[model samples]
Target: EPEVTQTPSHQVTQMGQEVILRCVPISNHLYFYWYRQILGQKVEFLVSFYNNEISEKSEIFDDQFSVERPDGSNFTLKIRSTKLEDSAMYFCASTGLRGLRNSPLHFGNGTRLTVT
Candidate 1:
């Protein structure tokens, strides 16, 4: 079974610093997405990328956040300036198919970002 892989399982940074979280989705998958969960909150969708462009994005994906696929296999999320509230567990996910109402998303273990 193919799965998403994320680097640096844990990261600690000071507020106002920049951070880039990297991920490699299942090679054959076509849809990629980034989701996050605050310590005690529900998972929130950040953005979805398909066909080399952003297919959809949540309100949380503001000017401070960006996503890219520098290569065909690697997808990355960058936060320009971290804030205390930005601390969360960020997950990278992918799906092999699209347009199905119930298509499942396979997720990575997540990178725990701690901003102090």
Candidate 2:
């Protein structure tokens, strides 16, 4: 079975620095998303992308954050300036079907970003 792959399983950065998290989803999947979980917080949806454009985004995805698919296979999330609040485990997910009830999302193990 195909799965999502994330690079640099762990990252440590100073506050106010920039960070880019990368992911490669299963080849056949259509919908892609980025989600995050702070150390003691719930998993929150950050943004969703489809057809090379942002489909939906949460309040957390503000001007400081951006996502792109530099290549058809890789998806990346870039934080222009990191804050202490930005420290969290970021997950990449993809689903072939549209609705949540129709298909379950396949998620990567996550890239843990630590801001100091």
Error of 1 at 104 (Å): 0.6
In candidate 1, list every pair of residues with a backbone clash. Answer: none
Total clashing pairs in model 1: 0
Off by over 4 Å in 2: 97-101
> Taking the tens digit of each residue's C-alpha lDDT, what string does model 1 give over 15-90?
9999999999999889999999999999999999989999999999999999999998999999999999999999
Model 1 misplaced regions, further than 4 Å: none
Which candidate leads in lDDT? Answer: 1
The global C-alpha lDDT for each of the candidates, from Candidate 1 onward, is: 0.95, 0.94
TM-scores for candidates 1 onward, in order: 0.95, 0.95
Give per-residue CA lDDT, model 2, range 13-45, as digits (tens).
Answer: 999999999999988788899999999999999
